[model samples]
Target chain A: DQQVKQNSPSLSVQEGRISILNCDYTNSMFDYFLWYKKYPAEGPTFLISISSIKDKNEDGRFTVFLNKSAKHLSLHIVPSQPGDSAVYFCAANPGNTPLVFGKGTRLSVIA
Target chain B: NAGVTQTPKFRILKIGQSMTLQCAQDMNHNYMYWYRQDPGMGLKLIYYSVGAGITDKGEVPNGYNVSRSTTEDFPLRLELAAPSQTSVYFCASSYRRETGNEQFFGPGTRLTVL
Candidate 1:
């Protein structure tokens, strides 16, 4: 069974619009969550992360929201640009354990 | 610094063949991990090492073995390759675990088994 799940396989957004990607987890032991963006033929790069203690964290145009009670998280990108197109993976880690990843969601930003 | 490096960007293996995928990191990290990503899927851990001489299996460790004789190197061995083993493999290193520390990943190695 998958502990973390990205139900949406793909998401498309127009330039200058907001994009949201959602993820859910079945395990309550996860304390930290992260997002990674991967371009074709390259390794996934770190995007942003949020701790279970906080409800939201923002960096520039990227924002991550965490809801511990719901066991859910979402990544938001404001004014999405074409350069933001890539595969995004949601990952979570329990204390003192390795990360568990969900199936990635492919984001397409049309300019 | 070359944070992490993997050899043989792409390879093709025949059934029953054996090979070792080499991974090295220059960041002097205490943690190293190996993962495999199938097409359109997220990465699944194969093996990991906390430090030199300390290695452990991950979610998917069947048909694979690993060794960490030194801090800078971790090698994954595939014994008796099978068709189901085809996938892209990645190597990553982090300063620590469960600290929200981002992992630095190397260019992946794509392998196909016939």
Candidate 2:
């Protein structure tokens, strides 16, 4: 069974618009969640992360919202740029354990 | 610092061939991980090491082996490669396993087993 899930396979948004990517997890033990972005032929890079203690965290144009009760999380990128186009992966970690990742969502920003 | 480095950006192997994927990090991290990603799939952990001489298996460890003799190097070995082992493999390292210690990744190695 997949502990973490990204139901959407792809998302598209126009430049300067808001792009929202959603993820869900079945295991409540997960306390730390992170997002990684990957370009073709390259390794994934850390984008943002949120802890269970807070409901929301924002960094510039990027914001991550976590709904603990619903076991759901979403990443929002405002004024999305074409450079933001990439595969986005959601990962969850339970304390010191290795993270469980969800199938990625490919995001495309149309210029 | 070369945060992390992996050898042979791409490779092709026959059914019974064997090879080693090399990984090294200059960050002096204590935690290192190996992951494989199939097309349209999330990365799957194959093995990890918390420190030199301390290695453990992760979600998918079959058909692969790893060794960490020093803080800077970790290599993965594939014996008798099979088609199922074909995927892009990544090497990552982190300072430690704190709640949110982000991992640094190396350029992946793409392997094709026929």
Candidate 3:
């Protein structure tokens, strides 16, 4: 069974618009959530992270909102740019354990 | 620093063949991991090492083995390759096991078992 799940396989957004990617998890043991972005043939890069204690974390144009009660989290990118196009993965870890990654959601920002 | 490096960016193996995938990190991290990503699937942990001389299994350990002889090197061995083993493999390392600790990853090695 998948502990982390990204229901959407892909999402498209126009430049200067907002892009929202959602992720859900089944394991309640997960306390730390992270988002990673990857370009074709390249390793995934860390984007942003949020602890279970916080409901939201923001960095520049990227913001991550967590709803622990709903077992869901979403990533929001405001003023999306073409450079933001890539595959995004949501991962969860239980502090001392390894991270469980979701299938991933491909984001395409049209110029 | 080179952060993390993996060798043989691409490899093709025949049935019953065996090979080792090499990984090295210059960050001197104690937490090293090996994960495999199949088509349209998320990365699944294959093996991990807490430090030199200590290795353990992860979510998927069958048909694979690993050794961490030094802090910089962690190699994964696949015995009797099968078609099911074809996937892109990733190696990652982190400074410590804590919440929100980012794991640095290698470019990845694409392995095909024919």
lDDT of 3 by residue, A3-111 (tens): 8999999999999999999999998888789999988888888899999889999999999999999999999999899999999999997667678899999999999
- TM-score each candidate: 0.97, 0.97, 0.96
Ranked candidates (lDDT, high to low): 2, 1, 3
**What ranking of all candidate models by TM-score puts the best one first?**
2, 1, 3
At residue B93, give the lDDT of candidate 2: 94
Model 3 clash pairs? none
DockQ of 1: 0.74
Candidate 2's displacement at residue A64, Å, is: 0.3
Q: Quantify all predictions' global Cα lDDT against the true fold.
A: 0.93, 0.94, 0.92
Tens-digit per-residue lDDT, B30-57, candidate 3: 9999999898778899999888999989
- Model 1 chain B scores worst on lDDT over the 10 consecutive residues at B94-103
Native-vs-model 3 lDDT?
0.92
Choose 1 or 3, whichever is better by TM-score: 1
TM-score (0 to 1) of chain B for each candidate: 0.96, 0.97, 0.96
Candidates sorted by DockQ, best first:
2, 3, 1
Per-prediction fnat: 0.66, 0.70, 0.68
Return the clash pairs for model 1, or none: none
Interface RMSD of 3: 1.2
Clashes per candidate, residues 3 or more apart or on different chains: 0, 0, 0
* Predicted complex 3: CAPRI docking category: medium
